[model samples]
Target: MQRPQTVVFTDLDGTFLDHETYQPGPALEALEELLAVGVAVYFCSAKTRVEQQAIANEFRVDVGFVVENGAAIYATAGAATVFGMPYAQVREALHNAAAACGAAVRGYGDMDVAEVMEHTGLDERRAQYARQREFTESFVIESGEPYELSQAMGELGLRLQRGSRFWTAQGEHDKGMAVRHVTTQLGPNAESFGLGDFDNDLEMLTAVDTPMLVQQHDGTWRDLHVEDMVRLSGIGPVGWCSGAELVLRRHNAR
Candidate 1:
């Protein structure tokens, strides 16, 4: 029997891409090697479809992606498999949740490109891409703990997820669900690897066969306690380099 095809599901902003420069840096070589071997590198990220698709196109990769914190998955065939509410519904739900909890919140739908750039420091092009969201509403709470907000959203059957920069409100579907869906389509010939650097990455990390934590920008790990997890001892894309090489090592051995 043929060996299972390797697949990597990764977070983007502070994992595969450098937080400051937003480039792959040292992970480029390993990414190339993986692609050379036909490994699918699905970018499971908080980014929107436009942003993720731009990256895939820029890198010349044909691998599908999970976008908007698993609100949708793009299969290798270029068909989108959406798993949750539409943008208008999600935005309305967030507003209702915030009002119900009396919490002050500002989501991307409430912000223009200038405001988004101000909050995120993304360039004009990236800011435009961010605004093209379809499923999740990324926001910030100007108030205190999100406990009340979480409860409020939960009442409406939505989940509040925290990313490295923002909190996103979407349906109950998560990265793990999206990854599982993709792998299921790949049948039994799938060996999955996951890499992340923040608390929001917990679901995706736990769903994969090999879960690796990339070092955070502050030189610390994400503090997740996944079983048999590997902590790559480098920061941002530097740690991503370690993870990519490790995946290559395993792939070559197989």
Candidate 2:
């Protein structure tokens, strides 16, 4: 039997983190363990690069990361490379898109980093902690159809990614593309696993050999690809962590 070396990529919110509080549970420990055993851990998130970096720092692991829904890729310890649209173009297109749709646009760089906590109703302590670090530019808009947003972003030479919560301007990037990019950098033979729990995660989940879904309390799992899926009996981060352990155990046995 061939033992496949695995790399794990996870989405942040509504998957690993509690959707309401943004807290990590037992699944976080499983992630650390995976890292200890040399399975690469990467974060593929709708978060801005700044937000992702703060979380990565908390993990104390130099994992590769894909941010802005695949608009940018950052080396664990080096420069961040843009894979989608340039920042300026994304800004302009987002402004126009917001105007057309009567929506508001918020950029990580435009407001004080503290504003995220206020806007999203995140904890103030978390916001303060985040403010202490350098942040990457991220933008959010509330309007436009998914395809329309995608096309306009494309015209600006950037990628628009739609996630569970919001639409963001990163560049022309998606979680699927980010997964492929990281895999390519790690070499072709590395086995990969993807974990997520929402519509935006579909592409990444489909791209990996072992895809896990973090079950939610509202029976959202029923609407996803449940066939052959390894369901976590728990909810939030605990369920995600449970699912990861199961996947790791199964992988090791093979």
Candidate 3:
């Protein structure tokens, strides 16, 4: 077996960030080592561009980021390349759907970050943290069937990515597509690894050569399509960091 130049792409929440402190642990060190050896690290996440950019800066390295659940891609220098439906088109469709379902449609584009925070009742600090970086954009419909919203977005040339607590019109774009794009850019001989821990990460996990899911607070592993999905023993970023290191060690041995 050949050991090709590797690139690791990881989802943020519940994967790279400690669920409590929102900080990276040994995973960051592992990534640094990979970079020391000429490997690349990227963050593919549902987080907005703003959020992902901040993380990239914190790590002090350039990152290829897929924001808005793959609706947009951004390079480390802050140049953005949108891949899917325009936000305007998605907004119109979501508005129509909200009216039909008698729900209120709220999003980040139409309002400032503060307004979105108020509507969603999210913590102000977290909202500010998300706003400081501009990588993600999302819309939610309050009071309607989530599937109805999904169907509506589908009709409008958008797709709904269902997370633990919200539905958004992100289009058919997903982490899998983002991974393919990055891998293609990196060349055919490049090896890939992925880490994630939620329903939204399914496509991403399937696209990688190695997929690992960090354990949740409940001590259960999220179901994944990969045949060799490894369940980490700890919760949040610690588990993710440990799992990523293990995967790399195993792959390097092979």
Candidate 4:
């Protein structure tokens, strides 16, 4: 197989999609340009595999995806490189860890489909997709401090990561580990780029040669510090566009 010279990994929520609207309208042009030049685009995010595949289907461009906060990587061929514990295992461990830490948490497993729709602002169909978790669990911390819960989780070799809206429990993993896995497949010379807008994205950003942070909906950048990281001023898709433009220039595709 011929080697890819450039690869892009972007977070979905609050990075490539609007935090509230979940639209990628502004970034479409740049995204198309990247695709036109055969630049690989992968959505690396906390979204479920179904949600990620839906986005890829909508845009019709997905070399692969890192889903559930790096719980797994799904190639376009449908093969998955898994890094997370099974969903059932993670869910059970989470409750046990939370109980030990005296944390009151409400996970998706505890919610009905309707309640998941309400909390996530997803329609019934999308809500079902969200609940179709294969690995890890997303939950709201109802009454416990995250620090204590995190420590308790560590004892079981699990971890808790905070996304834009909820906390996730899974095997110790992060987007960076998945990013590295994809780039390695692309070969050592492939220049990887990543974009994100939250602390949850720090690991992913650090894993790329060109890391960029999009401004949040509140017009602020994440306090994510990484060497040679670029800060884009626009929120969500706008910032994604700017970053994509830079990638195009770097790849000499524009």
- Provide TM-scores for the models: 0.92, 0.77, 0.83, 0.92
CA error at residue 57 for candidate 1, angstroms: 2.3
Q: Is candidate 2 or candidate 4 better by lDDT?
A: 4
- Please give the CA lDDT of all the candidate structures: 0.88, 0.68, 0.71, 0.88
Clashes of each: 0, 8, 9, 0
lDDT of 4 by residue, 1-254 (tens): 66457889998888988888878987877888888888888899888999989887887765588998898998877888999899999988889999998999999999999999888788998999899998989899999899999999999889887765788888978889999999998777799999999888889999999999999999988787899999997999999999998998888842
lDDT of residue 5 for candidate 1: 84
Q: lDDT tens string, model 2, 1-254?
A: 43445788888887878876677867678877777776877788766567787887776766777776676778666767677655565567767766654556676546674676766566776655433322223456644455665565556555555444444565445678878877776666777788887777877877776778877756457356633556666666877877678667866765
Task: Tell me the tens digit of each residue's lDDT in model 1 across 206-251.
Answer: 9999999989889988789899899998998889888988888888
Better of 2 and 3 by TM-score: 3
The pairs that clash in candidate 1 are: none
Model 2: residues with Cα > 4 Å off, grouped in runs: 1-4, 77-81, 96-115, 124-154, 158-165, 217-222, 225-228
Model 4 TM-score (2 dp): 0.92
Clashing pairs in 3: 48-135, 48-136, 49-134, 49-135, 49-136, 50-133, 50-134, 50-135, 159-171
The lDDT of model 1 is 0.88
Superior candidate under lDDT, 3 versus 4: 4
Better of 2 and 3 by lDDT: 3
Residue pairs clashing in model 4 are: none
